[model samples]
Target: MFRFLVGRLLILIPTFIGVSLLAFFPIRLLAGDPVALLSGERVMSPERHAEISHQLGLDRPYIVQYLDYLWKILHGDFGVSISQKQPVLDQFFQLFPATLELSLCAIIFAIIIGIPAGILAAVKRGSFLDQLVMGTALIGFSMPIFWWGLLLIILFSGILQWTPVSGRISLMYFFPSVTGLMLVDSLLSGEPGAFKSAVSHLILPTIVLGTIPLAIIARQTRSAMLEVLSEDYVRTARAKGLSTFRVVGVHALRNALIPVVTTIGLQVGVMLAGAILTESIFSWPGVGKWMVDSVSRRDYPVIQGGLLIIAGLVMVVNLIVDLLYGLINPRIRH
Candidate 1:
């Protein structure tokens, strides 16, 4: 296990280098100039444009700029956002908690609802319940996140007036951002109604973000369970006169979870990708929305840094999932 972990960590070094190279070079090839975008609607003279480019190192050769950026990255510097004029890492850390909170809630919602639905569908293979569950999962999987988020806003916010249209919490509640997560910060504030307000605001976006992962997890779980149920060990458990719950839940589900867990791990990347759309639609003030706005303004540092960081996060999650395989099935530890 120790050697396995070391090997995985060693692999990440090159993986991150590749990710950095991919992130750095192509973005420079994009048509828009960050300095020009930073000037907004203003028309600058040639001399001023040249000065600004020189100041920002845009006048430097692409290879030179990339090497300098790579050196800075190695020294824990992501550079300042060309638009925001603040450190990219600082802005990212400020916004990341909100994204983390949303993603965590979304995944939890998916797991709680999806896994049981899957188990029931698998247990009752050809029954109506299975059909209904599978049908819903299929719909969830097929739906576009942006379209679904907008529909929810139209129904819940526009028509019913049940949920907030955008933002993390009601502006009525003021609290210092301890964790940068509205839900946690609200509770930490010790103010009246803040927690409820935060939760109310979270509902629509959470549902929108979670729906796809829930569908995928449910489908994976059902498939795994069906395969596991046919194995000799499952039949042996049933023949031993163990309760049906024990046979399915303990024997079948545990074995089935190996693949399902892998699917769940992969869903983290999906959730982050979907959050880009969901956050934009809802104006949720997370890293996804931040990155999107940066793209429009051609904020090179934020774009390159955010992509590299997010890719690194996905790699870390995959590593954790690999480690979890050993815990779930000891044979993998070898």
Candidate 2:
């Protein structure tokens, strides 16, 4: 296991390098210059443009710039955001926790809602409850995150006033900046009021982000359970006088979870990367919002840094999923 993990970790260097190589030149290849865009063409003179370019190291040859970027990356210097005038690493770390918190909540929400609904749907296939659960899953899968978030905000926050319309916490409650995750910080500070507000604000965004993954897990679980529940071992367990629940729950669901686990792992990365729209809608100050803001301003460092982090996360999660497959099945370890 150690050897396998080391091998996989070793491959990440080249993967990151390839990502940088592909992404670096594209900004210049595109129609506009980053410096020109930041310093508007209307008021900027030739010398000012030259200064901006020099500051960004755009005046150097592409190869030199690429080598410098790679070297700085090795030394944990993600470069300064051309627009924000802050270190890219600082900006990334500052906002990443919020997104991580949001994504964790979203995944929990997906699992709690999706897995059981799927099991029930598979257990009672062709029944009204089965149809109902599957139908809900279908709707969730079909709807867009932005649309779902809007509808939820309108119904729960706007009309009913059950939750906050936007933001991480209420203006009334004070939360410490310890963790950058408002909910955790609020709890640590023993502020139930702030925690509640943070949770309430989280509801709409989490639901919108979770919907697709929930639907996917539901469908995959249903299929997996359907297959496992009909296997010879299930019949053998039932024939040996095992309780129906034992036969299904212990024998069937345990094995069925392998595929479901894979889906969950993949969806974790997706939810993290795809939260841009949800974050924008809910005004959540997460990585997604940071990426969007950076992109709009042509902040190459932030854009590249964010994308690099996301890619690394996705690769790590995939590696975890691969290892988990062997642990769960016990068949692939050989």
Candidate 3:
């Protein structure tokens, strides 16, 4: 287990460097200058631009800048945001809990619904229920995230008034962010309707973000369950007079989860990346939305730092998944 973890960590370093390269260089090549953008509607004079560029070290050669940034990253410095003029890491930590909260809820929502749907679909493979589940999965998977979010917002928030269209909570309730998660914080606040408002605001975003992952997990689960159900052990369990639930859920699902676990692990990365789209639509103040805003203003530090951190997180999640995968399969540990 130690060697396995060490190996995974070793693999992470180079990939993380690649991610830094992706995050750092491309944004610098973007049209327009952050220096000019800083001045807002008025264009800065060339002399002013040069002065600001030199001050911010933007005048340095691209290779030099990348090397310096890379060095700082190794020592855990993400530099300051070009636009916000704040430490990028500080902003990231402050906002990350929100993204983490949303992503956690979204993935949980997917797993809770998706796994069962897949299980039933597999068990009743030839029935209408199976077809309907798979059909819905197809639609959910195919639908664009932004468009789907808007549709939900219109239906639930606009017409039905079932949930908030955007933001984390109502402005009526204010509380210090003790844990950074609104739901938990709201509870701690002891304010009536605080937790309710947080949950209601979260509902649409969770549904929208989780919908695609749900489809993916459902399909993956169904496929895995189908394969496992046909295995000799599953039949043997049934022949032994094991109950149907025990035969399918216990015997089959235990083995089937090897691959399904991988799918769910991969979805964590996808969900993190996908949050950019969801956050934008709903105006959720998370890393995704921060990255989007940074792009518009060509905030190189924020963009690079945000992407690098998010990439690292995705890599870490994959590593944990691999460790879990080994524990589940056992054969891999050998």
Give the residue spans of candidate 1 off by over 4 A: 330-334
Q: Please write out the lDDT profile of model 2 over residues 195-264, one tens digit for every residue.
A: 7888888888888898899999999999999999889998899899999788878899998999999999
lDDT tens readout by residue for model 3, 178-206: 99999999999999999999999999999
lDDT of 1 by residue, 144-179 (tens): 998999999999999999999999998888878887
TM-score for every candidate vs. truth? 0.95, 0.92, 0.97
Choose 1 or 2, whichever is better by TM-score.
1
Per-candidate local distance difference test: 0.93, 0.86, 0.93
Leading candidate by TM-score = 3
Count clashing pairs, candidate 2. Answer: 0
What RMSD value applies to candidate 3?
1.2
lDDT of 3: 0.93
| Clashing residue pairs, backbone N/CA/C < 3 A, model 1 | none
- How many steric clashes does model 1 contain? 0
